[model samples]
Target: MAAPLDLDQLQTFIAIADTGSFTRAAEEVHRTQSAVSMQMRRLEERIGKQLFEKDGRVNRLSEDGERLLAYARRMLRLNRETIAAFDDRRLEGHVRIGTPDDYADRFLPEIMARFARSNPRVELSVICEPTVNLVEQIRRGTLDLALVTHDDEKGQSEVVRHEPLLWVASSNHAVHEEEVLPLAVGRPTCVWRRAAIDMLDQMERDYRVLFTSWSATVIIASVISGLAVSVLPECALRPGMRVLGESDGFGTLPDCRIGLMRGHTGQPAIVEALARHVSESLDNITLPASEEAGMFDFAAMMAMRPRRHRPNMMPGW
Candidate 1:
């Protein structure tokens, strides 16, 4: 008969093998060194094989340990899957969601609050990154769903919501022909940065990049401090920022498309519910005239109309 294996012991063994030091493994597992050593000893006894070799002060995984690592990973994954399958009805499965920093800051809190209320047992895992990174993660099956900006030049994915980009700057900054506009931007993969640069180029405006960061907070802070101009969704702008002229002469920077993309085949109903909630939240975003007109859908307007209006009967009647 195969020996019974303990997951905790296996985890400790893997940790020790990876770190090559009991102290490090213990720290990683939030256990004392003696505890880690005890677990490893127990694991070895159960398997009836030496899994590690002590060379001086360092510990190295033996050939048997190397072979068992693969089995350990498979067993752990299966164990987790089994637990999730049984516990899913209680809203306890892990959900991996990806979103850009701007949308995450502006809208995620409210959505998460609503989701939490409905799915009290779910564990939400969020990854905030640029649209490109999020899309890649979604494609790679690392993320369960993503809220990402669409590339206009590229075909659309399953679109959930579409909003337009807007140019914004500090309230104190003035646009002038002589003065060089300082621009704050995110990293290269950011769609907003590309739009900002394209707008500046098309308008024959000379601008200098003053700050660049992947963080929305950093970009907004730089703009708020009167450091630079940036292009962002109208919904992302806070109170202190001012719109630089209404001239669409900068050209349409393309609509910001948000979508829910599943990583692989099977998705929990809770994940789909969260995706729908996110799509619904996008409806609440107010847009400027130019942006609003661009994304206007006849179906949405029809839905907003009052279905029936009854006139009050005259008192004489």
Candidate 2:
């Protein structure tokens, strides 16, 4: 008869995989480093497969370890769901989550507040990064969930919300009319940046990249300050910004999509619950029935603001 696998050891294994160091894994799992080491030793013996290997100063997963990771995540997720199905108390635990600065500005506040109220015991550890970095963290088992910009070429994600991508410039400035147009955009890997450049190239428009950054604040600031023009989501329409259209020589842009990605660490109940909240929260972000014919006004959405304090850097939603 086959021996049963140990759930405690599996949990410890996942911690080590996430941290990439026995010491850090020990801190995360609340066990001594030696104790964590012993658990891995036993885990390897139980499965008769070497799981870890030495890499410079940190531990790296061996080929077999990578295979086990998926199974371990699945088992742990199932166990959590089973417990949650029967537990009488409110759901609890930590959720390591992330999103790019753009979404962080628009979606996170309400989602955070709603999630906290419903699951007060669930601790939220958040990070703000670009989609590439966020997806990398998910692959490394560091992030439980992330709201990201969805692009097929960058990373695969379950798209949750779609918003029209629009070009905008300062309502009071003529920056967009510069013969050699100055533009502020995200890093080279950004899909929005690629789209802007591609359209310009097709139009044979003279242009120059005046600023490149992964930060939405920096890009948006450049536009508001009349330093450069930029493409932004509908929700990013600030008070001084005006949407550009065909008459302005800027072509219509496709919809920008928001997606969710998860890590192998599998906090399923917590992650899925948060994912639902994220989707529902984005549904509240609405634009006028038609694009505004005048300078974009953020105050028009004031009625949509939640009856709560809005965080700095948060967008009007």
TM-score of each: 0.57, 0.64
| lDDT of candidates 1 onward, in order | 0.67, 0.77
User: Residue 95, candidate 1: how far off, in angstroms?
Assistant: 0.7
Top TM-score prediction, candidate number: 2
> What tens digits encode model 2's per-residue C-alpha lDDT throughout 196-228?
888898889999999999988999899989999
Q: Across residues 91-164, which tens digit of lDDT does each residue of candidate 1 receive?
A: 65678888888889777886786566556677888889877787788788898888877776664356666555
Which residue window of length 10 is worst by lDDT in model 1? 308-317
TM-score of 1: 0.57
Give candidate 2 misplaced runs (Cα > 4 Å): 1-87, 287-317
Q: What is the Cα-based lDDT of residue 189 in candidate 2? A: 87
Off by over 4 Å in 1: 1-90, 175-178, 247-252, 285-317
> How far out, in Å, is residue 316 in model 2?
38
